[model samples]
Target: MAELQIAEIPYEDGGIRYRYARRLSEDGTRWIRDGRFTAYHPNGAIASEGTYSDGIEQGLWRDYHDNGRIAAEGQYDRGQESGVWRYWDSDGRDVNG
Candidate 1:
């Protein structure tokens, strides 16, 4: 698996300066295996986390609410939904119960 290097791009929201790790989706598939991809909210919390295979999502992927809660978790096979799915609310509570 290739290592991830995060960098910040500057922007402004309500005059409060902030930075976000840029969107990292690319088409290269030769380097990353068992890879982890992450995105963050402007408030500095987790926005999403997932694994990829040859550039296609092939495992459990979790997406968070802006409030740092898990909004969804599910399995993917070659980018298509392919298993049990769980969703959560903004408080990190599972909604699939």
Candidate 2:
């Protein structure tokens, strides 16, 4: 049995700034996302955060505005959006209502 090795990759978009950091695991065949994932805004603020299982999104996920306020949040099941999702404005006010 081959031990799964995790790799951390930091990516930059257009050579401007860091875009996202992803963790991938090799399953003896191919590399797939299998851990925490975080994306950043061009200004360095976190744009989104979530987790993945075998390249499929799973569990809670949150997206933020460039100003650092929560923009949206919800759950993911097998890479599909699940349950009720909440949204907020850049000022942090809930936009669902």
CA lDDT of every candidate: 0.65, 0.75
Q: What 10-residue stretch in candidate 2 is worst by lDDT?
A: 15-24
For residues 1-97, write the lDDT of model 2, one tens digit per residue: 2334444345455422323323434445555666677777777788888888767989999999999999999999999999999999999999898
* lDDT string, candidate 1, 1-97, tens digits: 3455444433356322222222333655333334566666777677777776655777888888878767998899998998888887787666786
In model 2, residue pairs whose N, Cα or C atoms come closer than 3 Å (at least 3 residues apart or on different chains), thus clashing, are none
Kindly report the root-mean-square deviation of model 2 from the true structure over all alpha carbons. 3.7
TM-score of model 1 relative to the true fold?
0.61
- TM per candidate comes to 0.61, 0.74
- lDDT at 84, model 1: 89
